[model samples]
Structures are given as structure tokens and as C-alpha cells.
Target: MNDSVKKRNMKVYIGKIKVMVFERGVCMTECDILIKGEKVEPVKEFVYLGSLFAYDGKHNTDIERRVNGALLAIMNSKSDSREARLAVHNGVLNPIYMYGSESWMWQKKHESGINAVAMPPLRSVWCLIKINIKTVMLESGMA
Candidate 1:
């Protein structure tokens, strides 16, 4: 094997997420990013939101920043079809969802929450989902 080739292999891959799942003493794992790698954000926290959601943002600054923004958005709305959830990375639209995309944009009339999504071309994000009860109800039932 060439020296250069070996060095390259030793390098970490970017934009990857790593997941660890353990049950009944058996261990299962998956990942999307490598620590200290190019294109990958730092690991911030380790979280498991039941079967609904899961991610690590404890040690990752990028993850922490984004998550903080998301939480803020969720808090502000609090009671309607707010943002619900956010899928952001490096202030860009992250299309790839690691096994959880269902109901991300989910809306519940009685719910109160939103996602503080970030955008590109600078810290900007559109579409916060403003729900007008009058407008929503007008489109349904015998009016």
C-alpha cells in the first residue's frame, strides 16, 4: 500500500453522523460524521427523544448552536402549527434526514411549538408557518 493512500484512509470523513444503539446486551451502531473530520460538525450532545427523535449535540458546537436556535423557535410558537422541527446544518438546508422525516413539518391546531430554522446567504430563514385559525377553518367543513 502507498504511504499517501494509507494517510488518506486515516483521515476522517466529513458530513457524517454516527449513531449507537444498544439493547439486550447486543450493540448496534451507525454514523454520519467523524470527529475532527472535514465537513463534519463537532459532537455537541447525546440525546434520545423516545422513538420520535434522537441526535447528539453535547460536544458539537455547530450542533449546539443550531439546536439552540431550533429550541428557541419551538418555544416562541408554543400552541399551533408553528415550526415543529428543524433540519439545519451550517446554516443551510440539510435534505438528508437520518431515519426521521415523518411529521417534522407536522401541524397540530392545539399544539404550541416551532423550529427556528436557519437559512443561507447569511443567518436568514423563511417559512415559519403562521397559522390563522380563521383561514384554516374556512377551508374545511360546511362553510
Candidate 2:
């Protein structure tokens, strides 16, 4: 509510900060929902999540980072077109792992050789759908 308080809040957005696994799901907990942004990051991890997780390291390695990227994409959504859908899909799925700790990102970018914006890419004819997910922290005032 004061000048110093606002400056502190903006600091959270001005840097590349890493959130632990526990803090992965809260986007609206620590700051106001001002200009949420998403962008893909390079993968670089080997944390085993097991088979049930279907996690492709080369692709889904940065699970946490991608999720943040996807969230940014959601904030940038404009309409329900093909590119829009891809952006949305990329945004939502960017952070999530399909198998367990593995995400479809690697598969599409590597083995499948498809860009995140190409339609009918891997999941078939079904276009991407945007889901308005409500966070637990959002209800409060801290994410």
C-alpha cells in the first residue's frame, strides 16, 4: 500500500527465481496478477520420476519452468484459433509432466519433431482448450 511495499513486490517479477517443488502451484500468492507471462525454457535435469510418470528428460526436464511459461502463455491468450490453441496447450502442458515427472515437450520437440505451434501435431484433430484453473493460494492473498 506504500511506496516501499510496492517496490518490494515488483522485485519478485524482475528476476529469474526458482520455486521449490512445494511452491510450484501458487502463482497468485505473493503478488498481484499483473501481466502474467509464459515462455519455454531449455531442459537440463535427470531427476528420476519412474515409468508411471512418462517423463522425457530431454523435453520435460524443466517441469517447473515450463509450467511458469505456460501460465504466461495463458495470460497472453487472445482467441480460439489454431495458433491460439497451440499457445494455450503449450502454456498449460509446458509445466505438466505426462508420465509422472516427464512432460510431452521432449517428445514433441525431439522424437516427434513437431513444433509447439503446429496443429494436429501429436494429440490428433482435437484442438487445444483453455481451462480457467483457480489456485488455492489465489483465494487467499499470498501466491
Candidate 3:
């Protein structure tokens, strides 16, 4: 322990602590984390660096949270241009969802939710292109 850490109102308690078990089966043993001779509560899930972690090693909750955030980003954008919306979707929202996607296990419902969130901006781009193509063809007498 350093004086600077104490001055910052931070205290590090060290003592015997129970090890966490990560497995497919349910944990059957009773265990507790102890610090400074005090029992520290166990947590089921925690968020770190924009990713959600669970004791059971599931990503569903985190994926849902990311999806909602992306949808909100789309909803909050003020630009009516399809290109602008696409930019925000690709630049701001997609990275959030795809950050740790390589580690995620595939679930039908989660996949559906991700696909649904991704559809709107793509649809907007399609519509914008369709309208432009129609206008160009009409102007060129090729409609």
C-alpha cells in the first residue's frame, strides 16, 4: 500500500479469496470471496470496456444491449439522407456490435435481432439508389 493510494481514498484489502470456477455445468459447491477477513459478495455479471461478462459465459445480454444502443443511434440521427444514416450505422453502430463478435456463440434469436437492427440503413440505401436510378433513366429517355 502506498501513501498516494491512501490519499486518494483508495484502499486495497488482501486476504484469502475463493477461486471462481468457469464450467459448462452448474456450480455445485458453496464458495465465497473473502477480503480483509470479510466475505465479499459474488457477482453474476459485470461490464468492462463496453463488453458484458457473465459467470455463465453467455453473450446474449451484452448483444441485446449493443443492439439497443445501435438502434438508438439510428433513431437519434438528424440527417434524412440515406448516405448519412448509412455512415452513422457503419461508422458508429456496427463497430459497437462487432467489437467482440468473434467470441460470440450463434443463437437464432440473437442473430435475428442483429440482422433486424442492420436492415434499416441498408433498406434506406436501396431506396435512395432506386429513386436516383429511376430519375436518371427518365431524364435520359431510357425509362
Candidate 4:
């Protein structure tokens, strides 16, 4: 590893990167990898491309992170116009929730996590608008 760094004339910053090993089966073993004279600590999970991957094949961590990020995006978009805010909710938050969803064998907890993040913006949009009485009556079959 050190040799490759030296050969490429590249500098490695030890603090900025992590090294994790994903195991397939049950085995009690510890292995260390070295790069540029730095020891890499092994982790059970790692975040890559904004998604979390774990050795235990659980997506709780990933779901929590995505939900939290979506909520943060909504909270921080207070200065944007209504349409822009909706765009943030739809474009940014929805994609974050939907990304890698096909790979997930979703449980009730995962569905709840997704709903917890999705509902706030929708409720906000509904409350922010004034409903005309005629439209409301028509929708209620009174028109």
C-alpha cells in the first residue's frame, strides 16, 4: 500500500478516510490493512454514495440517516417560495427516501421511518394554503 502511494506520487491524509471489512459468514477473526504507513481500523458499517452498508444486512442505519437528511432539507428551506419548497420536498426528499428502496425488504419500522419524514412537508403544504368554500363544498358533494 505504501509502495503504491509512493509510486503514484500521491499524498494520503490518514484522518479523512476509513477502512471497513464486510464479512459474509460467521468467523471470529481480525485483520488489519495498511496504507501509506497508516493502520486502517475495521468497521462493521460504512457510508458510501450517501447510503449505508452494514455487515449485518440491516438497513436501519441507512433509513435513519436518509430520513434525518430529508427533514433537515425541509427545515432549512424556509426562505424558499412555496413552489420551491414543494420542489425541495418532492425532488430532494422523495429521492432520498426512494433511493435504494428496491433493494430493501421493508419492514414496518422502515415504512414508519419513511412516513415520518414524508408527512411533515405534506401537512405543511396543506395547512399553508387557504381553501375556498366553493371548492370545499364541491369536493364534499354539496355543490
Candidate 1: which stretches are off by over 4 Å?
Answer: 1-92, 96-99, 103-105, 108-115, 119-143
For candidate 2, give the lDDT: 0.35
Put down candidate 2 lDDT per residue, 22-44, tens digits, no spaces: 12232323323222353222222
- Highest TM-score, which number? 3
lDDT of 4 by residue, 1-143 (tens): 67887899998887776665545576524767777667777677766556767765554546556656536655446565666665666666667777777755556778666666566555454343555545533432323
TM-score of each: 0.17, 0.20, 0.45, 0.44
- From the highest lDDT down, the ranking of the candidates is 4, 3, 2, 1
Give the winner by TM-score: 2 or 3: 3
Single out the weakest 10-residue window by summed lDDT for candidate 1.
113-122
Model 4 TM-score relative to the real fold: 0.44
Instruction: Quote model 2's TM-score.
Output: 0.20
What are the per-residue Cα lDDT tens digits for candidate 3 across 86-140?
5666666667756776655555777667655555545454444334544533432
1-25 in candidate 1: lDDT tens per residue?
Answer: 2355467776434435534432233
| lDDT at 17, model 2 | 37
Per-structure clash totals for the candidates: 25, 16, 0, 0
RMSD per model, one decimal: 13.2, 18.1, 10.2, 9.5
